[model samples]
Target: MFNRIARFIPVLQWGRTYDRTAFSNDMIAALIVTIMLIPQSLAYAMLAGLPPEAGIYASIVPIILYAIFGTSRSLAVGPVAVVSLLTVSALAEVAEQGTAGYGVAALTLAFLSGAFLALTGILRLGFLANFLSHPVIAGFITASGILIAASQLKHILGIGAHGHTLPELLSSLASHLSDINGPTLVIGVAATAFLFWVRKGLKPLLKRLGAGATLADVATKAGPVFAVVATTLAVWVLNLDDLGVRIVGEVPQGLPPFTLPSLSMDLIRALWLPAVLISVIGFVESVSVAQTLAARKRQRIDPNQELIGLGAANLGAAFSGGFPVTGGFSRSVVNFDAGAETPAAGAFTALGLMLAAVALTPLVYYLPNATLAATIIVAVLGLVDLTILRKTWAYSRSDFMAVATTIALTLAFGVEIGVASGVVLSVALHLYKTSRPHVAEVGLVPGTQHFRNIHRHAVETVPEIVTLRVDQSLFFVNARFLEDLLQDRIRPGTDVKHVILMFSAVNEVDYSALESLEAINLRLKDMGIGLHLSEVKGPVMDRLKTSHLADALNGRIFLSQYDAWRALSRGGPSTDAA
Candidate 1:
């Protein structure tokens, strides 16, 4: 009973092992991530079309909850670029930007998304994330990066521009070109360039100057905070705000407040589609981060447990005056590099963010929105990896198709459309491939008790006995295909009286497939042929024994195909005569 309860809540597993060493490592990692997340959280909140402080609110409680419930040792949970873009996309249609209803709808999205993720975890439905393949995710991220950057261009230019897609954003930017504020442009351009340089060259340059690796890494992570501070101070000193530059003015100072997500039926109905999309996207992102970090430490992550952890994190965000969030790729990598020893690191990060909310909110009053936009641009630009398209295309055409379609749909229609289409496309491709599984005609390899596909090897065969290898499990999608295939191959009044099915690759037999097998067995029975199974896997054999197929057998299940052939063809070929 205790173990079962602990499985639902994972803090029990690591809580006992928490010690001073773990605490110190966590605190250091938390400090680095908190420094990085302060500006990022604020920028992502703006990206979601919410107030800047909402981002801070998101990072605070969500990190603590995920740390307690999540399985990854180093995964940092908060406003990721793609999830934020998706959040804005989902909420934009329901409520106008900057309205109370918009914030409420965003909160509601977090609630619905959290509930959905938690339900999936409870049901152990982590396999659902497999529908979004790595290539598809890469393409989607690259496309989302483009969209996020495009969306932020207005803030960088200090103009009022609004759009949902690439073309729309570009068109709006062009229409508002004359309204661009020069001071905002200068700050945005310079900060963006400097941040990019800091990411690409600053670490190596610091190392060359005799800085230790740890210090260099921390310096690199703090680059954005430096930019925010430097730019904020500049705007305050240079009076850039007087020149019509938009500033993150009057951010509330305090820890996150408790709030209830609106649960109106209409809100639920409206956000349902976006909620589902966010849930799937968030799960995939979280699991990938968990698996990668776990691999670094030679540990294994429970995908199902991770779902519960991320679900709990999102739920925490919803109730804590924030919007939906997920495991951030950059932040997780930073935590891993910074030597985070456990999920406790995330908890410590939450404490740091809480302190920032209380003591640091007033300082950002003069922080230019362009600086935030620059931070966002630099952050999301890392997510854009067009190289994946070329790599997948060169490796596999099928994967390339999935990636291309996801990218195109995401760029053209929006995130919700891209993710939805990617799922549908992936499922359809899987169904298509499974509908006509590999059916290999087999014969014995000379002097061996093994069967090989006839087309792939030179083999020996008895003319009267034919063996076939079914490469896929018996399922509803391809059950009839097998039936038709056997019918087309077997000739009436032929010398073949015995047929063996090599069940090496067959993993499952659903009801529809079972009925089809029965039909095949009865048809072969009428034709005076015996159907036998050889090399049936243990679990499949167990399932067969529970069914009536064994008792109603045309022949018998053999331990090996060679044994069946020898028993059935005993008189025809014998070593004793030799």
Candidate 2:
């Protein structure tokens, strides 16, 4: 009973083994992650069109919930760039930004996403994520990174621009070029450049200045906090807000507010699809990061349990006045690198964020939106990798088409359409390939029992006997394909009298395929040709025996292809078929 309960609540399993050393390490990691998450939460909330405080609210309950139910020791769950962008996309459809309806819709989306994830976990449907191909995911993320970076330029330039796609964003920015505020532009560009420099050069400079490696690394990870502080102080001192510079103003200073997501049927109908997309994308990203980080330490995570954990976290967010969130790649890496010993680190980080929500919230009142935009711009730009296109192109044309189509559709249309199209295209590509399964004609090689493709190998064949190697499972999609191929290969005037199908590679024979095989048997019987089966797998043979096709077969089933070849060769000339 205890083990079963522990399986569902992972923290219960790990908590008994917790020690003092773990406590020390977790506290240090928590401090580092808390510092990193504060600005990120605020920035992502703003990106989601929520008040900055909502970001901090999002970071708190979600982390604690994930720590309690999640399987990863280092995965820090919170408002991520992609999920936040998705939140904006979802809420935008139902209500105007800054409206109460918008905030309620955000909560509803989170709840819907959480509900879907929890249900999937309960039903053990985590394998559904595999249907989304890696190339498609890479393409979608790369395009989303570009879109996110472009969307932030409006804040950087202090201009009004609104769009979900690349072309629309670019056109909006172009039209608003004349309205760029000089002060905001300066802060945005300077902050962006500074953050970039910090990422590339600051750690090395700190090391050169006699800082230890750990100190330098921590300082490097805290680079965004430095930007926030410097810009916030600069605006506070210079009164840049008076000069048309936008700032994160008046963040609510308190514990996360108790709230409930809207239960309106209309809102649910409008947001449910987006919620499902968010849940799938978020779960895939989170599991990937969790698995990668766990691999580094020789640990493992349960994917289904992770679904439950993330579901619980999002549900916490829905009830706590926040948007949808996930395990962010960057923050989780920071937590891992900072010496986190367990998910206790995440729980500790949540405590720190709660403290920040109460005390540190007021400090960011003058933090410039341009700096947050700069933060988001720098963070998401790292996710953009167009090399996947070149890699896919060099490997497979079909994969290249999927990646290219996903990228183009994402940039041209939006996130929802791009992802939907990628999934559809991936399924279509799979079906197309499987529908025309490879069927190779084989002949016996001389002085050996082996049979190889007649077209590719110099082999001996019988003029009156033919053997075909079916390389794929026999299913409804490709059942007719095999029928047509056999009819074409064995013409009316040909001397072919016996046909053998090598089923060594075939794993299944569905009902439709069984019907096709029966049809092929009847047709061959009409033409005075015997249809045989060789090397049928045990399971497939058993399935075949369940039907009348096996008894109705015109020729005997052989245990092996070589046996069939040997038995049939006694009655024919061993010359290669023309």
Candidate 3:
């Protein structure tokens, strides 16, 4: 009982073994992650159309909650770029940005998302995330990266532009060209270029300057902090806000406050679908990062418990003046690379963020929005991989089509529609391929018991016996196809008296397939032919025995195709016994 309970509350399993060494390691990792998270939290909040402080609040309570419930030792849960975009997309539909209603809608979205994830976890439906194929997911993320970068460009240019799709955003940006602030553009461009260089060149430059490898890495990870401080100082000294350069303005300094998500039916009905989308996308992204980090240390991640962890984190966000958040790829990688020994590092990081929230809010008063936009641009650019198109195209055209369609739709429409279309396309592609399963006509190989595709190998076949190997599971969607293929293979005057289905590859037979089989058996019987089954899987055979099909089968069920061949071939057993 205790072990079963511990699976749901992972902190219980790790807490008892906590030690001084673990504490020391976690504190160091916490300090590094805290420094890195501050600016990102602010930037991602801007991305979500929420106030800067919401980001800090999100990073605090949610990280603590996730550490208590999550299984991964290094996953850093907080506001991420894609989920921020999704939050804006979902809430922008129902409420005007920057309105009280908008914030309420965000809270409601977090609540709905949390409830949805928790319910799914309880139901053990983590496998549903797999319905969105890897190609589709890759396409969605790539397109979303492009969209997020485009969305942040207005801030870089010091102009007002708003849209969810590429065409709209581009048109909006074009119309605002005359209003760009020169100073803001300089800060944005220089900050963006600096951050990009820091990502790729800073560590090597530091190492060449005689810094140790670890120090170089730590400095590189703090690049955003450097950008934030420099821009804030420049803005403060020059009074850039008077020159039409936007700043973060005033952010509240204190711990996250107690709050509640709206429970009104009207808000719930409007936000539920978006909430579900956010939950799935967030869960998939979080679990992917967690599993990857866990694999490096030869650890395991329980997906269902991860759902609960993320769910609790979101619920914590909902009640703590925040919005939907998830495990971030960059921060989690930093936490792992910084030598975090357990999830307790995340909790300590939360404490550090809480201290910042209490005392550091005043320092960002003059922080230019352009600098934050630069931060977002550099962060999301890493997610865009156009090479996926080339790779998928070279491998499978069908997969390429799914990926291409997802990217195109996401760019043309919005995130929700893009993801929905990807899901539909993935399912459709799967059905199309499975509905026309590969049915190979087989014959006995010379001097061997094995059967081979007659068209591909030199094999012996009797004039009166026909055998086919079904290469896919028998399910409702493809049941009729099997019936039609079998009908097409057997001609009226080919002297076919015995038909055998090689079942080595068929792992399942659904109700529709069983009915199809019965219909085939009756049809063949009326034509004075016997239908036999060979090498049926044990579970399938058990299911068949429960139905009347086994008793009504026109021919014997052989343990192997070779047994059927030996019994039915020339100078063998009689037809009825065989």
Candidate 4:
């Protein structure tokens, strides 16, 4: 009971060792992350088509909840770029952007995603995440970054650009090019250029000016905050809003007001698939980040528990009028580098965001949409890894095909179709490969009791007894191949009367495989040829015993191929039931 409780709520394990040193480290890390996250939160929220304060709200309680339930000490949970984009895609389908219904739909998505994640964790079904191959994921993220950057071009051009795909966005922007607000475009372009410079140039310049690496790193991450301040100030001083500047305008102040997602069955049913997709993608991304960070410290993460943590965080986000979030690679790295000692850092960061929600909401009123767009563009652009395409092409052409297909589909269509198609292609690629497993003909190695692949080694072999080693789990797909290979080995009236199947790499034998084996036994029996088994795994032997296969196997089951070779070649009883 105690173990179960601790497993569900991981804070109990880490909280037991809380100390003043840990407190100090966590506090400092939290401070640095809070400073960095403020501008990011507001920007990401805007990107998700929510009120700016929703981003701050997202960072607040969700962090606290994740700290309480999460297993990782360094994983900082909040609104991240991919999850925010997913949120927009999910909500955009149900209601118009910026509508009350859209907001409700976003909250419901968070809740559903959180629930799905929590259920998977409880069932310990985290291994299902493996379905999304790394290459496919990389392709999806790269394409997603492109789409996100393209989508934000409306803010950059100061026009009413609207679309989900890049082409549509371009077309829409072109249609409204004549109506582009000059004032807004100037501010937007300037802020975007300044932020890009800050990200690329600031740290190097700061280090040359005697700034330490740690301080420079923090300041570099805080560059967007500088953009927000500068642009907001310019807008206010120059009365830029009066001249077509799209400011954030009024933001609701105070704590994140508690709310509940719409439970209407129609809404839930409509948003169900998107919620599940968001949950799965979010979980995969979170686990990957958590594992990488844990490796640096020689610590380990429980993927199952991570699901629970992220689930709780998303649930908090839903109820608090935020969107889905996960463990962001950049933020988690910053937390680790800033020397966070425990999950307390997340809680402290939450407190910092809460303070921002209460007091700093007014300061961002003059913040230009262009600056927020700039922040998102700068952040997600790093997610675009074109190197993956080259690497996949060199590594495996099949993987390259999958990666290329996923990227092209994502960009040409929208996010939903892209993700769905990517998953299907990944599964298809796996099945196509596994359906044609590598089968090797084996022979006796020189002066050894072991068998070796005939092609790879100079080994002794007998024409009468052919041995095959299958290097994959036996299932319906490749079951027929086994029989076909056996038939090719056997001649009409040859000396070959015994066939030995060496089951070394085969871990599982499904019903279809068993049926295939029975067919082999029956056919070999009709031909007066014996079908033998060597090195049958214990579990497989037990399973065979449960069926009539052992009784009607047509030949013997040897402990090893060497024993079978010794017994069969001795020319004992050549003719039996087989």
Per-model TM against the reference: 0.92, 0.95, 0.96, 0.95
Candidate 4 — which pairs collide?
none
Residues 1-578 of candidate 4: C-alpha lDDT, one tens digit per residue: 87789878888888988999999999999989998898899889988889888898889888999998988889999988888887888788789977889888888999999999989998999998888899998999999999999988889778888888878988998999998888888877887888889878999999999999988988887888888898899999999999887889999889998879999999999988988888888888888988888888888889988898898999999999788888887789889999998889999999988888889888888989988998889889989998999999999999999999999988888888888888898888888888888888888998998899999999998877878888888899888888787778776787888888888787888888898899999988888889898888877877777777778888888878788877787764332211
lDDT (Cα, tens digit) per residue for candidate 2, span 1-578:
99999999999999999999999999999999998998999999989999999999999999999999999999999999999988898888889999999999999999999999989998889998888888888898999999999999999999999899999999999999999999999999999999999999999999999999989998988999999999999999999999999888998889999999988898899999999999999999999999999999999999999999999999999999998989999999999999998999999999999999888888998999999999999999999999999999899899999999999999999999987887788788888889999999999889998999999999999899999999999999999999999989988878998999999999999999999999999999999999989888888988888899878989878888887887786853332111
Residue 479 miss distance in model 4 (angstroms): 2.5
How should the candidates be ordered by lDDT, best one leading? 3, 2, 1, 4
Q: Could you tell me how far off, in angstroms, the CA of residue 398 lies in candidate 3 after the best superposition?
A: 2.0
Candidate 1 C-alpha lDDT tens digits along 1-578: 97887777778888888899988998898899999999999999999989999999999888888887888888899988899999999998889989999988988999899889888988999888887778888888899999999998998898999888888999999999999999999999989999999988999999999999999989999999899999999999999899998899999999898988998999999998999999898889878887988998998888888888888888898999999989999999999998899988988888988999999999999999999999999888888999988998899888889889999999899899998888887788788789999999998888998889999999987877888899999899999998999898897988888888888899998888888888888989999999888888888888887777777778667777777778676643322110
Residue 326, model 2: lDDT of 91
Report the Cα lDDT for candidate 2. Answer: 0.92
lDDT string for model 3 (518-577, tens) is 999998998889999988988988899999899999988888888889888864653222
Name model 4 segments beyond 4 Å from true.
Answer: 488-495, 569-578
Candidate 3 segments exceeding 4 Å error: 571-578
Rank ordering of all candidates by TM-score, starting from the highest:
3, 2, 4, 1
Q: Which pairs in model 2 have colliding backbones?
A: none
Give the lowest summed-lDDT range of ten residues in model 2: 569-578
What is the overall TM-score of model 1 with all chains considered together? 0.92
